[model samples]
Target chain A: MRVGLDVGGTKTDAVIIDDDVHILARTRLATGWGVDAVGATIARAVDLVCGEAGIAREDIRSVGVGMPGQVAPGSTRVAHAVNLGVRELDVTRTLEPILGIPVRVENDVKAAALGAHALHGSGSGTMAYLNLGTGVAAGIVVEGQVWRGAGGSAGEVGHISIDPAGPPCRCGQRGCIEALAGGGAVAERWGRPGALPVRDVFDAADAGDALAVALRDDLARGVASAIRVLVLTADVDTVVIGGGLSALGDRLTTPVAAELEAGAEASAFIRSLRLRERATLLPAGSPAAALGAALVGRTTEEVLAHG
Target chain B: MRVGLDVGGTKTDAVIIDDDVHILARTRLATGWGVDAVGATIARAVDLVCGEAGIAREDIRSVGVGMPGQVAPGSTRVAHAVNLGVRELDVTRTLEPILGIPVRVENDVKAAALGAHALHGSGSGTMAYLNLGTGVAAGIVVEGQVWRGAGGSAGEVGHISIDPAGPPCRCGQRGCIEALAGGGAVAERWGRPGALPVRDVFDAADAGDALAVALRDDLARGVASAIRVLVLTADVDTVVIGGGLSALGDRLTTPVAAELEAGAEASAFIRSLRLRERATLLPAGSPAAALGAALVGRTTEEVLAHG
Candidate 1:
């Protein structure tokens, strides 16, 4: 048995699973702040899941946590995790003693990609899990392993600006896809004066709200550009959409697919890319990040050793 | 000793090298038309290089060819070499019987990437060879191996449109980086009625011709975007600039470096990419593609096996 924890900006989710990855138990709690709060929240999830599974912590072979920020490979020390107000913090060392198990921590998006692969894998080949959430990022699976680049920053496509003449991003850049496609950006642009919540922005577009429709189309373009970048650069077999914004489902995917189709119509070479065909969606209500965190340690060890 | 051949669109370059990759003999001949001419061109290169090196065909261990288009892994059957104006040609099977040695073929850009890694290798790590020439493309090396995607269409970044409202590309696309950055595009935009040769375009820009300056800057942006794309996706340690257009050298690299520097100033996240520091130039007069071709068979075998 193993344990997985997804430490997010808003919530901390946990899961305990058998050897075959069948989820034995699961729980969620509001994510706390600081190293102590973060450590306490993680400990609570681990304890609750262990109790629910009716298994002792001794039997958990590996416990993995996926959190935001730049995490050192194979260790729980985060180089920087601004969202969690973490910097150079060693969460693993703090949690292992409390939980009575060895723990590993990785970047949250990367863990989600692993989880998506483990549960809804296509057997073999590459799959890029694009998380369109509060922030935008990707978890790139090259073959069956995560492709952590030379600086441990392989899938940092969120900040890659597609439009030079577009709006400025909070990442201190102009025209980033994240600035254009992330949930916060959508809410900020169209949810002003509390007129349209981000949740109803899509429904408003469906009801023919001009501002909402334009914003949604902009989001689609950004999403399409992300797919194009992933397909053109990495040639990933599939681009699975995840994260909070993914709750919009077909409303988000359909227009993004349409944008790719339009691009293909313009270029035979771009048509060969088949970005639309390569795009996919995570199943609804999938706790992929937590589940993926559970397997992060073993997978990271195997991949780093092999790579 | 091994024989390597780079079958380019305009010329076929060949080299005979020892085990340490020391060049013993080298020659170039005009590239030919049709499968028979193409096969004959490769055969002639082998014959000439062997003669110059005072070695018999029997003494050679391996002969490899690098051509454009999609090459199957460890096989010489090209899916389609548009630059060569040929499709689905089996060059290896055709040459092996005549040469009395097994011949392997690889994509030209990919071979150039391997060549770049072999010649100016940083021991072991990812290196991206951004070929900004007649057409724009990249050769990606991950852990001393070529990263051929599931469809063998990994490094076709030329058609990745950076500007949606740019111009029409021959690939039936609008606003591709190639449309704005490739040598052909530069010539088309600025070359007219003895205005400037493609070779003199940069010199004219240096002479302060407004038109030439604009065209050159456009190319710089495209090249910069390519580096950003390569780094953001693969995070290669160093990106070596190669291909015919790379002959411009610092005139090309300086502007590209400047563009990346500007992006860094705008975004801390972009700064972390350190694109300028990672950008490199292939040594002048280097026969990287041919030499890389020489090592292609062995390297391809190792990588595909490992992958």
Candidate 2:
């Protein structure tokens, strides 16, 4: 069986899958987000996932882990992950001994794109997976492969300057889409000091809360702009929304679709590109990133290349 | 020998290339911008180029042509070319009878990308050719192949809205980066009627005219944003500036590089991306599109696919 691990800011998910892409077992646990904690958490989750499947850790062919940061090309060393406070962690060396198997690492968003495309892509052409959770970014799939880009930064679109005069992002840029529309931004703007979750904020907006209404509208606009940028620039055949905010589904896409229509009405080129028709939502409970991680590395060379 | 033709708004350039990629013959002439004028113009250029090479049309392996607009896949039928007042013209069908040879068509900017990569790319990875002439757009090259996005709309980044409150573009969109920075927009903003060309706008800016400085600054910002978009999203290894504006060279890139440095100072991710270092200027007067168009088709299937 193959092992896939997705390490995020709030959760660490692990899965075991057979060659046919069937999930044999899975595990989800809170992510301890520090240098030592991250490594331990991933190791525990891997052990727990293997145990659940009643499989020996030695039986696993390889471990593929996806993290939310820059991964050194051809290695599992994570250059940095500001959110998780990870710096220069060599995942391959650290995990290879514990698991007694080979390890491959990739950026979380790129892995998610690969997963989304593997499960949902028809293999017709290129597609993008837009991840909206604590942060917003996109992973691009070209010709059935993840476009890792020159510096391994292909999918990092979270900090694009959406509004030059808007609020500042954690990355020190101002008016980024992530700051205006990501779940973290929404929670922060609600000013509830973690008392109100992102879902609660959305629920309040649905119930006619005045501030929630405006914030929701702005969020929709930011998401809409993100979609436009993806469609207009990359011209991907489909854009699947994944990550945490994906659970919101139509409540988010409805506004986004409306915004697209409004823009298309004004621009013939936009209308011709058919941006709205290409937007899709990931399945409700599937671990897209983990599955993608599990599915990658059909060969050792490919695994290293993907890393 | 291979033949290439670049059909532009103002001029048509043709070149013949030997198997060694050396230029055997070259020709340039004014292009009339109507439907019939476009076809006849391309036909005349082909005839002139062949005559210059002292070869019969039948001796030419294939003729490749690049134009600015949407080219129907597998054919030379132009869907629309507003700048040239041409629509639905089948370049292959019309030019084949005139030139007595096979023909392939591609977007001029995309062709320029191929040409630029062929002439300058290190073959390390993806690269972009940012053409700033009558309009602003990009042509992406990956692994020495043009990446025509899923919808064949790849590298068309001109119409993206940079500022919601900015001026209007010819495409009926408001505040597009093209409107803020493209040659057409620069000429329009310079407001000297036919007296001031785009080059003159830069000249006035260099002479320290107040409006010219502000416009030049805005153009630099728009171009810098274009670079950021290319780097952040596609992560191309290098971006070579081409087209009419490329003649300005450092006069333009100095400001654009400055803007990039300012943005990088604010965002660590941007700094790490090394967007500034990745930016390069295409050498002056290389006839990138013509050369690319000439060397584009080595096989019938490849030619049709490129079309």
Quote the TM-score that chain A achieves in each candidate.
Answer: 0.91, 0.89
Listed in order, the DockQ scores are 0.67, 0.66
Residue range A200-263, candidate 1, lDDT tens digits = 8888889999988988887888888888778778878888899988887787888888888988
Model 2: DockQ score: 0.66
Scanning candidate 1 chain A in windows of ten residues, the lowest lDDT window is: A298-307
Expressed as tens digits, the lDDT of each residue in B193-263 for candidate 1 is 44335567788889999998988888888888888878887777888999887777777888888898988
Against the true structure, candidate 2 reaches a TM-score of 0.92
Please give the interface root mean square deviation for model 2, in Å: 1.4
i-RMSD of all predictions: 1.6, 1.4
Cα deviation in Å at residue B161, candidate 2?
1.3
- The digit string of per-residue lDDT tens for model 2 on B1-307 reads 8889898888899998876667789999899878899888888888899899897888888888888878755656776887789877788888888777888888888888888887887557588999988789998888767877777777777887767777788777787889888988888888887643666878888898998888888899889878887877787889888988888888898999999999989988788888888888988878788988886656545533432
Which stretches in model 2 have alpha-carbon errors above 4 Å?
A30-33, A54-59, A82-85, A207-210, A299-307, B299-307
Residue B166 in model 1: lDDT: 72
